[model samples]
Target: MSVPVEVIFKRPEALRDRPTHYCPGCPHGIAHRLVAEALDDLGLRERAVGVAPVGCSVLAYNYFNCDFQEAAHGRAPALATGIKRGRPDTIVFTYQGDGDLASIGMAEIIHAANRGEKITVVFINNAIYGMTGGQMAPTTLVGQKTTTSPYGRDPEQIGWPIRMAELLSTLVAPVYVTRQALYTPQLVRKARKALHTAFRLQAEGKGFTFVELLSSCPTGWGMTPVEALEWGKEKMMAYFPLGEFKKPEAEEGGKK
Candidate 1:
């Protein structure tokens, strides 16, 4: 008899079988894989709906095996709110970048979280805008150089980088809020756990949940993938430390 080998790795059924458009070493691919794995593990692939806004992952619909909708720039949260409300049985989520979530979509995200919409949000904070150009974003670290900030970001004029996880945690409605990263294998594992928690919260009808993943944009940052990951661990992690900012009570399946 021939010995059989166990399949240790394979694409999640929730993710479409297609090559991603993300540049080499971009963390978006990791983020997508985590989301797909969560959907598969949670048995939500059949009903999960994703909302993708204008950004690097704007083509998200083409990648997810589940249904996906495109939202206007900075408006993914609002769109997700509507979808979740109209189809409460469906698992709804929004994948947004720093430029779309923290900048133009600031108010939309704030209100949606405040309202406790039954939705999950996957926020990718790469610090600099990656789609349109390498421009300064609301989450850009101070002294970080970008196309619009050739001299590095000036706090005196641009203000400090917005801490979305901390900001959203201050609100009363969100069931869970966390900041994670994908720079290392260890961090990537934690990020996947956070993603799973956010989705699990929504599956249980626990109000709004948000997980911010600190990602690297090698092309935008003008560095190799390895260099970007190193920079992220040294600088970005200093500003956006990874941890759960908030969670429901332990009795309610959240961290104490």
Candidate 2:
């Protein structure tokens, strides 16, 4: 008799039952799924420890099945540092949004990269703040309007969106840095690969892997999910070009 094949299309063992608390069309859920899938693919679900930040994903602990620690606003890297230092055997990672990572946590994120912490950071950049009533985030586009930037982001007052992947790549300590978007089917597949690569780098004990995902916030952006995805491709991608910023071998010979 021929052996039978089984197919499965269910939640990963590393994810929990609580449906995501994200608004409709928010890409946070997709990002969460990608992270969970990466953990499963690396066989590190049980050994993974996630540090949830204070933003849209603040309650990420309730969504992921692995052990989690809730960090204060902009303190996820600091907390993850402690966790990784204490339990070097555990695969530590942090999930943070643009407001949390590029704004209040900028120093922490930079220092962590400078120190070459053996951890992975998944950064969701949706342009504007998704939580707290759609305020302007550090990654908000120059022409984007939020509650705080009702008249659109004025470059005179507010600077341009921070290119996080490029900024981190300037540091020599990190081993991997990449920027990917999830606005289209092909981009989504690319994002999955980037997430998987980050997890793989962590598994290999490579230093400081960072993946910045260009996500969408439809509700906050005052558009349908489909429209927001289109905007990301037409506008967001122009400013934040996708691709790996830094890799281990590239830096080995002093090349960026």
Which candidate's lDDT is highest? 1
10 residues in a row with least lDDT, candidate 1: 247-256
Per-model RMSD to reference: 1.5, 2.6
CA lDDT for candidate 2? 0.91
lDDT of 1: 0.93
Candidate 1, residues 12-79: lDDT per residue as tens digits?
99998999999999999899999999999999999999999899999999999999999999999988
Residue 56 Cα positional deviation in candidate 1, in Å, after optimal superposition: 0.3
Question: lDDT tens digits, residues 6-83, model 2?
Answer: 866888878887878788888888889999999998899999999999888999999999999999888899999999
Position 180, candidate 2: lDDT:
97
